[model samples]
Target chain A: MLRKADTSATWAIAFSTVFFFIGGLLTTVAPPMIDKTWSKPFENNDPSKGPTGKLVNYTPQQLKGRAIYVREGCWYCHTQQTRTLLSDTIRSGWKGVRSPVSTPDEFVYDYPHMFGTKRTGPDLSRVGGKYDTQWHRTHFRNPRDLVQGSIMPPFPWIVEDKEEFESLVAYIQTLGRAKNWRPDNDYEK
Target chain B: MPEQTSGRVALGAGGTVPAIEHCDTTAKWFMISSVSYFFIVGIIALTIAAKFCWPSLLGSVQYLTYGRLRPLHVNGMLFGWLLPADMALTFFIVPRLCAVKLYSEKLGVATAVLWNIIVLGAVVTLPLGMNQGLEYAELPMGLDILVVIAWLMFSYNIFATIFARKYEAMYVSLWYIMGTLVWTAFVYLTGNFAVLFATGTNQANLNWMYVHNAVGLIFTPVGLAIAYYYIPKSSNTPIYSHRLSMIGFWALAFVYVWTGAHHMIHGPISQWLQTISIAFSVMLLIPVWAAVYNFFATMKGQWHQLRESVPLKFLMSGVVFYLLTCFQGPMHSLRSVNAIVSKTDWIPGHAHMALLGAFSFFAIAGIYFTLPRLFQRKLFSEVLANWSYWFLMIGGLGFFVTLWLGGFWQGWQWNNPAIPFIDTVKALQPIWLVRFFSGVLMFAGIVSFVYNVMATILGQARDEAQTV
Candidate 1:
């Protein structure tokens, strides 16, 4: 069959387009079409709503802080996704435990998803309520000062601007606490 | 004298050789631009590497902060360096192989200019905290439009030339080039434009689709085209088998699209998506190995040429690295291994082996092989070329090893609740230091390459002008 007349160009173009269509339909296009139970946030106490209830949305400040996160290209280093795998779960203590896997509903509000490719630092999936706002400010000023060997770049620029700094703090502290599964604490202070 | 006499004899038998209707001016300009970008982007990468070791180094400058500089380094490498090198090769090879001059030198020059403009926009805007936030498609909409315009001009010029070709039979390299051009345009539009309307996980899924395809369709096909043209021509042999080349080409095209989803494995995306991606990713090894074997078989008796020719040395070494990337790709795409290395440095190290080791080597070789011919003179210094090759080879290997092992060390430690996160970062300090120094060596190697290109092109041009 390979020894047939030269149709290399035609075959290459046709197969490439077809494979792209199939892959797109199955992976990219199909995921959003199928409704899953885990696509939304839920609490154990809410029996009527079930575990797939509509999760609370981010505050305006948190949204602004997310904008700051994207602006600074924080996603390049810090990934927000915690997989169901043991290694991922154990490493990233989501909700103060080694078990809460991230679901689609957690990212329903994410316009441009921050499921970063690299984890140069610890996962930020459940980083909200883990550290105080003061710690974030100091770390952003000089990461090395707080964590001796931290590779995170200093965001002194973000620190100088009070609005950007507070917004970013608001954003970081809300990472894992968006769902009402736990008593959501206001980390604004 | 005997070699010169034999060359004339070969020329006599090598048929019509149609007036050498080449776009030498545009081709030389593209090569020079690509080398300069290599120098600039190499320095930015070195800066990024240093920040990983000394977090406070240049931390005060908001523009040079790790986040901004990271994108700068990425865009610079992708658009500034690699893309130009690939386009330059297309400019040179397409015309010669088709026995026709480029359709429009003016359009080609315009494309090159606009290409750099789009990259310049990314460099300026990203550092200023003005960005669109998409990983590979980080440029703002205005600049993205400019990129599309530049690519359109380039595609039209090449296709017009090919359509009017005086040659009868289309070579395999031409087929590859045409496929790359069309697929690149399709993926770029779909990934960047169509993605703007997509929301949530759908956007993430499509983003990976674009990200992975950019490497698979654009760089892979174009790099292979350069290899298909140069390797056999240098070895004084036909391709090992035209039949195998077709199989490799179609297989690569079919398998790569399905494999993009592997990047999203265990993330917010569905389980079925991961399954399809991993299955196809493992299957991807077939095409990759087919090409690898074809290259080695083509060079069966000509292995000794590696010591003599710098271009062949780069091309052959690229094939070896290509093999490693494919092997590692399949292994890591599995759910188990990916779970361990997904967010760790292992993936980055592996990505570099493909980007810098495999494809970048091919680009450098294409430049070296074509530059002298474009200028009608031999290279100025083979010694400098050899030195550049070794430094990059050693430095790239060293860089990959440190990151690969350090990634595993960090991942394994992170899995233990007893090990604090900061402690993992501390333990990896020595590896980071090695990575930094090795990066410096790679930077030096690029500097040597740029200097050699300048000396050869300029020095030879001066000699010819004086002779005339």
Candidate 2:
């Protein structure tokens, strides 16, 4: 007995209401499920106490550079975390003669894993120990200069401002502190 | 036979059954070419996916890795198959809607041929791995230029036709079509940056912005326009509400662009950037929900048409999935939530649900609805059309659920310092198997639809053609 237009309007309202309810319900419930399934069992984990904690020794200049990195959206393309699994750790330089994996107890204090997706460029989780400050500066200025095939857009302007540059370096060094927690390594000396 | 001839003669005496036969032939050729293109690209994508399931199938070529092939499959679907067919529908619909013949048949044919050439360029460059490495901008710079040129030509032809309009008030559907064309051209040019040509860190921000707009401005508008036109026409009624349509259209145009940064949630981006992205994404629910409401409301009482009309079946089902994708998209944008699901198959599940489930379904419906009128013939088999609908619908649902669940599981395990990454992959092996099965079902559905479309265009003329 309903007119066609009325029927359509009613259907639209019903469908939208149903989906809205479903979406809201899922958001409310998803986090707990994630925690239940994924929470790690490491009790003694504290990233600052590990060998990579050498980053804690960063100078004021390096710390300043790190802050700038965060401000410029560089994290959108780069990740600062590595899994302990052999394949990923090896491929991303988290393990080898150059870099070794941190123990399970090392990572518990981390708030949000800064591991990024979309490797628009190489992984930056261990970049603090891998490249010198000058190299980092040049690469940030124009990535293509160092790596011919790199698709990373140059952050040349990051260098133009000395204060901002220092903050960004400081931020980048903090990324993998758990893996390099040893105190005497002098990460930013 | 004599009685039938006498009846036909009597009816024909009134008017000479205007010779639209030439239009019919050309339209058939266009449909056949486009559908074949769809089948070819679909099969290639399936094969690439299969290669992922069994890596040995790809031999030792770096070009065949999951990273490269993923972009190729996506591009093939978005550009090769979907875009061509949508263009064909536009060519057919714009003329009829305006109550005039297409302004230039030659231009239309030229656009169709250029589309194939651009897709061919993708085929050549992508396998060579000569990419810009930006997601959705993987087509090499040279090929990207070719595509831009083709789009410019197509936009020119469409706008010229619009300028030549005889109707005083532009219909809602025309607004959507014109907006999509103009907005896409501007976004494509700026985002790709032929001027900057891959220089600044702006590339990251620019890439996501362009790709998201491609979804919002280009595909979403075109799909909605087709739905608006066909749903009302097929149901033999005016749309449920014109004002709601205008509101949905404008709100979407304004709000959707600001949402690209949601993809960067929890990353090293500025806190404000991520925050604003999340805010706008959540706000997007307003316009999206309004559009969903309009679509369902328009179809409310017309359940009978859904049962009998193949086009209606595809269109209504598409609307259902569009609501699902938009809601999921905003949820994934939230930082707390994205902390777990970012960079996982969950993202692809949402993407496919939007592109395959929503846009492609509406597109197929538009094509099916226009076929009889354009070609002057009945579908080769309504039963096959019904089968295709159910196959795609069920298969797509299966694909979405399995991938989303698997991605969630992977995200959780990867973030847990106690859980080994290998263990997470081990846990997900079962889910990936489910994905393969669901993918098989989807592939079968696409093949069946392609076959049905081909038969309709190529089969011998029926004794009594069905009117649209």
Candidate 3:
């Protein structure tokens, strides 16, 4: 009976391994390699040349802010990716005009992808140019003061520390902006 | 792992075996650690839930920020509590089932110590803003390696015991345990390593895979393993059908791994990948129902046992939660439902229903059943045990239902861009308060349960000492 059970154990091991491999390969491995079915990564490590919009690379200051963003886990509440659906496109966009869906190419430089799982706050995919630098500084200090009933916790440190404030605002201002997306909109058209 | 020196000895040298030869020291330590952590994690969770309603309550200290505490809360609950709880139960239950002793109690204890170190590192560093930024896989690279080592040690001990078993035909519970040993390692390595090699959407896919599978492979199977054992044993009944157990085991192994990508539905991914995930996710029902059916069927005429037997009460409640959680899983994975509720408060509600509701109950039941026999004492207080149960049941139910309603409300509000986002936050404030209070009730239950167990064991030890 033990010998028979050993064989069953081996069978269990083999069955699960095979399935894990197949599932992982098809989902994680196959998609990037098969560009026709999915998406091709951006070449020259340039977000500015992404397919949907021209996104400039982050300044060094903005990169510093990006690190702070990651450290603070801003991604827990705010999602970076805007989906293809109308709700996401319009919701992320300020005016009647549609925001382009977040594609893999736009995230080429994103080493550890921050396509966050939750959206307690509104999606920040196209938050670039939505508010000026001063607005962000005050909002971070006391979120509820600017936006009544906002449940976001105050980050007074962001206001007090110059580097943390400037860099974070700089990085956020670069989210999902095309070369002339809001200015000369005819480029996208 | 060295085989036992003799039948009476649970391990070779280096183990201070318990006063009762049958009860392993490592199991006791792990159980005590798990219970203590469960209580600690509850406080952590309550703080976070409090911050959700009263955002400024904890102040703007960097270490105590929402993001840092959120990950710590998660890691504490998973590693500090559930994983060790399951490990402790495995140590106690497996040897008896196999008609053998543990491979090495020293190794088991060492692994438990290392596991604590790993969690401690996470608790400290996460607050200091040191993290890998992945949900569930947030431990930095160094600690992650330590985890792999700790897992290896525990697995070696467990597998060695199974190999040395005198019992020829392995029971259903043993099968589940063996499956978890293999699946957790595979899922962990893949999830952790994927960040190094994979990038962009592939990383996202792998991340969610890790997130989903961490529970599916680790907690779910172990919870079921203990359930398969304790439910029948505590209820004083034979298993309903051996064939059904086989079907359930094989089906769960087949369906669970592929469904991780369901978390990425309507997000940027290949359409086929999303399709495959949803397809496999729905198939999860087969295994869930099959196992649930067998458990219920086993208790056919044992209704009174559920009332009399404390372990049976928790195990039955666990089985019911398992059924509800699995049903919720597949329903939420659907495209339409995913669009509405994927990233809302609903997902956390679903998660707690699985962990706090189903798995924690199983762990509680296992500890209650095993500890008494080991220490040679009746429970400290049956009334307290029942009290803990009622508190948790009401609290867990209130917590889940409120978040679900809040999730749907927020989801609808977010979809309509015209509605100001602040309105949604304001609405959830009341729900968050309710969640915080529900957590308080759970914390109360945990305190009660832990107190009862500790008193029982300490009293039993004192009695034994007096007689000796």
TM-score, chain B, model 2, is: 0.90
Question: Where in model 1 is the C-alpha error above 4 Å?
Answer: A1-15, A35-53, A94-96, A181-189, B1-19, B460-468
On residues B217-291, what C-alpha lDDT tens digit does candidate 2 reach at each position? Answer: 789888888888888887777788877887786667667777665766654334555677799899989878888
- Give the per-prediction TM-score of chain B: 0.94, 0.90, 0.93
For residues B251-293, write the lDDT of model 1, one tens digit per residue.
Answer: 8867887777788788877887788889999998988888888
Model 3 deviation from native, Cα RMSD in Å: 5.1
Candidate 2 accuracy as lDDT: 0.63
Which one wins on DockQ? 3
The DockQ assigned to candidate 3 is: 0.53
Judged by whole-model lDDT over C-alpha atoms, candidate 1 comes out at: 0.79
Per-residue CA lDDT of candidate 1, range A113-188, in tens?
Answer: 7888988888898777777878888988877788876888777778889998988888887676644334243334
DockQ order, best first, reads 3, 1, 2
True contacts kept of each: 0.63, 0.02, 0.56
Provide the DockQ value for model 1: 0.50
Top-down TM-score ranking:
1, 3, 2
lDDT of 3 by residue, B1-468 (tens): 333334332323343433324548889889888888888878888888888888887766978988889999999999999999999999988888766688899999999899889988988899898877777888889999999999999988988987676554568888889889888998898778766676567778778888898898889999999999999889878899888988888788778888877887887777777888899899999999999999999999887887777788889999999999999999988998888898899988999999999999999999988887867777777777888888898899999999999999888887887787778788888888898899899888899998878888787444432332
**Per-residue accuracy of model 3 over A17-105 as CA lDDT, tens digit each:** 66667766776677668754233443343447533344456678878888888888888999987886778888776567777677666
